[model samples]
Target chain A: MARSPATSLLPGITIILAGAAIGAGALTYPLGSVFRPGPGFFPLGLAGLLMATGLGVVIEARGSDAAPPEPFAWGALAGVVLSILAFGLTVEHIGYIPATLLLFAICAVFERFRDWKRLALTAAIISALGTAVFLWGLGLPLAAFGGA
Target chain B: MDLLAGFQTGLATALTWHTLMYCFIGVTIGTFVGVLPGIGALAAISLALPLTYYLDPTDALIMLAGIFYGAQYGGSTASILLNLPGTATAAITCLDGYPMAQQGKAPLAIFVTAINSFVGSSIAIILVMGFAPAIAEFALEFGAPEYFSVMLLGLVAASTLTIGSPFKALSMVVFGLLLGMVGTDVNTGQFRYTFGLFELADGFSIVAVAMGLFGVAEIISNIGQPQSVIRDVGRIRMADMLPTRAEWRQIVRPTLRGAGIGSFVGALPGTGPGIASLMAYATEKRISKTPERFGHGALEGISAPEAANNASVQSAFIPMLSLGIPGDAVVAVLMGAMILHGITPGPNLINSEPQMFWGLIMSFWIGNLMLLVLNIPLIGMWVKLLSLPYNLLYPAILVFVCVGVYSADNNVFDIFVVLGFGVLGTLMRRYGFPATPVLLGFILGPLLEEHFRRAMLLSRGDATVFFTNPISAVFMGLSVLFLASVFLPGLRARLLRQKPGAVAED
Candidate 1:
């Protein structure tokens, strides 16, 4: 039996709703703060609204006559995610230049950069320019190679 | 005399060597990014914001404002030369701009667009100088309830933005509001959805969300398209780009009309430059002696929207600088930057920091002049840039996005947040959900929450205070009217039926 796109989205929607509920419920613990309305009040209200809205979406999706959802572009999505991760993990240790270069190369994989030499040249130029402007000229306290 | 004095002071401040250099740099960079497809003034400003950390606040703002208006001028260059709009505001320009180019009138289109942009922005700047203080004083009357109602109206208008299902747009907005709720609670000092993570304490940065949604998602969507070799306008001299006498005659009236429409729409929070351009284009078409002449490369069509867009960019500042309320995401970011510089933006800003306020306003006129000078000579260079491969461009954009986000707060967590939003943005695009509404929700969500809580507190837990406030009541009425027009089945059906061509256009 094949599942409809709406049905497939149910799990994601449910998770979102669960998160909203958890977010709202956690706020109740600190409802008696000193502020006129306190911090918990807004979060709890927003979280409840969010959960209700998510549930509404789920119900609406189930009833609507919209077409099946398009298949997610997992490759491009994964490439973006990985590039972000590489930049995050390496920015401090390897410095801005190396980390940015790694990200550029990873993102290059999304588009078919058939000419490796051209790609490498472009990446190098970008890294050099970025380093000059953001690091050297701006005098950011970023590590050049690795050590602080 | 006051205007002239303000202008003199502004000129004095703007003429400083450092400020002039930064102005040149700002317009140059703004034009470059604006020429590039998918990059815009907002992205340019975001990337440039960190650099301002080292500069004088007045100079930084002067340069930033230059870039903001410069992008509007540069955006028309792409729309005229290529059918592809560099920014959403330029989308209306593409309807007639491409046709004008095809008619061997590319230079005329570019020239007229630049002139109109200059005129429109000049008029708005004059208005800003004349009325900003008065407007700011008017805005001071607004309380939390009024602000909440205004935001409610904004969100409702944002919902009408999507050409597709209203329900989907509302869902996207709700999702954004929820995302905005992450990190430590502002009032309680307790983490709400950090899930044992310390980095989430600051909440997700607007830079992360904006870069991901506009920049990264755009790259993802454009990845698989077959690459095309850039076309060359061989030996097209710069003089050839200037508008002919007849072209000027056709464009002047439309340009004035566009400016009027832009200033009015831009004063409303949430309806900004993009909407102004669309409205100007539609109004121009409606009023034209020959409506059918519009898409066939009419010079008026290009001029009107271009004028409106530039005017809107300038007029949008009225709300931000006056009320300390931003009309859109770009202005919101600007407000954040101002606050970071220890400058409070509100009613007292004009009186307290007359130099900053008047100097900034005066710099806009200078910026427009600077843009005209900077844009004309560089048209050839931008045309050359259009030849670069998209594959090469995406990587550079990715790298820039990473660097820009990373530099903000020097936190790696921002990168992950950007990535998450990028995927979500890509999905939203594919599903025909409007992204601007999400931005509106994120910006206005906290304000709405604060106001709701405040109103509740003031009324001793009763909700009637929100209704009792006269200003709030009016805004709430407008919100209801907007929502009713959108959601009521009979009205929706009638409106949808009337705009059958809208679906085809979308």
Candidate 2:
């Protein structure tokens, strides 16, 4: 029989390293007494708890319907993340309008907005409205199209 | 504080033109947003949080609160009309609601949901008023140990109480706590997690994390799926709304029962309307003479869960406003918003900022009233909103999210953080791990650390102080019990396999 999916074990295991990395990064700080604990004290304890729970998940996974990982939409995932990244990196330099248009084009590719005219119209209208409200109305101090 | 005095002060503050306008805008936006599948109140509040920065603190809070409960009113509409729930809490409504719609009772189901929601909210509003002051007064005596233990209970409950794997939930909470450890340590002045970026000094951006995880992640997951809106938006007959005497008889008992269950569950640390609705539906099913009628077009099914859903949200404010512990992620985000405004919320908030507290109470009433008006007379307008293509709608949501995060501190880096968290949220959902606890852990993480450290310090280096204090010990005991209950079942199943001779229940 084919396995179902990795219910909770994978996510549980991931948090272990995530917690340890956090603790190791802050490991240089003094642990201090319980009376006057230092920066690392709390993180160290949290990391321990994370590791403990990860172990528990491993044990639980053994008795339960352990399954393989399922397929994910890599296309949708990359498109969304890259679009937001492009928006963030360019927004400060290119300003809200052009950056948003670029972000829109990147995202629209995933949605497959087949018509270029429709995509452009949607991007323009959204950017204009966003510029009007946030930039102008809220006075966020951003130029419409380019750098100050 | 006197009840009449509180309401009088609240009314005067909330009735102003600007506050009313903002409240109206929030309610309208909330209802529309709440009706959209895959977008919840958490996403809506995070995306909207930046817009409120320019307004007066009271107006901003009032608007946020409006979005909070207005979604409660509108969420069930989608669940009733389609099998799609607008938020997790509305999922129970789909059981009987979609079935009722199948029987061509869509308008009746919507109307019943509206009425039930109103009844539920009124009871919870009363509970908030009667209980919050008393709770705050009681909380004034809470020391570091009590705070630590209560938060311990909260974190444990968040991990174990939901309908998922407890271990995964616990791990996510720990990760969130670690995330909270980023930025310079307040006590030691040590920079912990910053990889040499100046923006990392303050903390990880809340808006970025929230919008990315909920808003952008939802969009990514929903991409390329056929998002069909209601087909009969303009076609519902007014005659379909009035229920028969048989249906009316089925409604009252369940609604009252649900309201009580909702208010009680709402005050608990980690549970919220979603759990309350589920429990209420289960209770309603158990008590019915014909339990088989539940998944059919039963009137009691529609009435009970809707009543519970609204009441739970209103009363969830109690723990948040009184004890500074949020009942769920949405409330945690609201608590974070309070912190962002330079207002420390706890027992002291009611004592120090009575007007702000009471004004918020009054605005919930005002916001609920506006939702009632918007929901009934203008429901068709909402259905029309539902028909907008998801492809068109989601990209706009992305733009709003981008602007919302950018406008917070006029920084682009927040958007980048959103990108990272969005991917995390997407993966978590795929793996069947709930994302809400991560948020809860993130928001509550700092406070939990502070209280634990303080309790330790106050005890003069004794870690046993958590167990020595009676109140603190009780809460800690509860947390341990919660963990045992979650683990013992899995443990028992494992043990059963080890000793296969043990008799198993049918």
Candidate 3:
């Protein structure tokens, strides 16, 4: 019946998001009234709504019994993010195919496929087909080899 | 007379090979995407946006429009055959569809749903033909206050009506508004949320935001889950696919009722097919003689909701094209695509660009017919797709998303921005927070702000402008009622002893 930390984290997140909204109001933007509202006016109002909503959620959570939250898939997420970051960093410098191949290999590791050859083959085919479709077919101006 | 004229224009424009070819392409791609898990029409459209840059605006519109409806046509395949809904709206189909398939009625289930989809869409198209012009005529009288007020209602309704925590939904809307406030302030020419990055000057790319949030986020989450189970399909025969006379008799009433409900529900701006299908399914269950047979391969179950889902998809276009109001996120994206094509869909669209309006209408009829033909024969092919491993599918989607987002502006920073949102969206889904509100907010935020400011300027800073105008006053009343209706039960339950019935009301 007790609310676990994982369960309680939702309200905390809502409150944090609201707090961030308020902090982003940036003081310099004029907080004009409803009549002649400034850029900050709507956002200020939104922030207030977020806070009230967050508080309501927090209050509601106090009485309700929340099931324990599922474990976050940090590994799969990290793999995807890192591969994208790697692709972003290298696509222009090292060219599209190599970067995409790197992206594929990195992402495949977290997918937990035991067959390395299949993984490599799948990665290569994806990179080649992707380049052919996006670069050559679509004329995207991406570098296939290393050089510009 | 106008109907005849509209059809003539449609014949001239939509019948062309170029338009026809693009429509074919769009629908094919849409069907492919719809049959696959972990992607919806929104993400597919986002991935296609960059590609559309090279196309004629009309052709682009035709293709994108095809994808929207085609996906709806195809989404039920996975739901029925594998108990997996490729899109949220098809979730209801899984209830009776899988049951029917389990009872050796897979082919018949597919056939009934496909035919029913055709029926639903045909009715919705007729409704669109009848009502769109009248709605546009009414829309012509809408000034800034009325526009802003209605959009406010849409925002509130979209946030509140979705399946999730109401507070989180509200927060997501506000979050979307805040995100919209980023980039240069339209009124003051001031840099608001941009942290001085040059790319931030133009604000975040809608392509990056939408693709990352919907597309990449889906891949990541789907990858985390175990692989989907595929059902054996050896027993089904071609003859079994066609509904018997008895089956046809059973489905006729439910199919007609579902289409009626769908057309009406889909016309309601700020709602989606998910709601319509659920309503249709529930209605069928309630009206059925043996309600207990509802979940266990009842023919009405597959036919009704399937029909409703497709009908809602088609009728959802009415509000978008005529009134420039999107009924859901997919239509909202379609609206964005229209804007991107330098065409603002509203009252003036009918008068100014009659060809485009009529051409699109014609395309819908042709497109629905194509889907009917395409879906029935392709059921086996779509079933084959279910055998595809989740591993390669994830990589293909991820890479496609990467390429699509990166190509939008060719900015590396956009990639990072997508990464940020992708993680946020993944986390959002993991929690109970809905993604639609944020998307709805992001799309509508700028329009709402622009209209709000314009309304304020027209009133010369009169604070009562929102209430003084009867149009805005009505919208305001609706919005307030909407919000109050959502939270009133929760508030009352907290005040009094909460009963099971009270919680079940939702």
| Candidate 3 lDDT over residue span B259-307, tens digit each | 9988988887655787778888888988888999988889899888888
Give each model a TM-score. 0.90, 0.94, 0.94
Clashes of 3: 0
Error of 2 at B70 (Å): 1.3
Show where candidate 3 strays beyond 4 Å.
Answer: A5-26, A32-35, B490-506
Better of 1 and 2 by lDDT: 2
Ranking by TM-score: 2, 3, 1
User: List-wise, what DockQ does each model earn?
Assistant: 0.46, 0.73, 0.63
Off by over 4 Å in 2: A1-9, A66-70, B237-240, B244-246, B490-506
Candidate 2 TM-score to native: 0.94
Sort the candidates on lDDT, descending order: 2, 3, 1
DockQ of 3: 0.63
Q: What lDDT does each candidate get?
A: 0.74, 0.81, 0.80
Better of 2 and 3 by lDDT: 2
Worst 10 residues of 2 chain A by lDDT: A1-10
Q: In candidate 3, what are the lDDT values of residues A1-148, reduced to their tens digit?
A: 5656556756546666765656566456887766778878777666777777777667666656666557778888999999999988888888888887888788877777646677678778888898888889887767887855
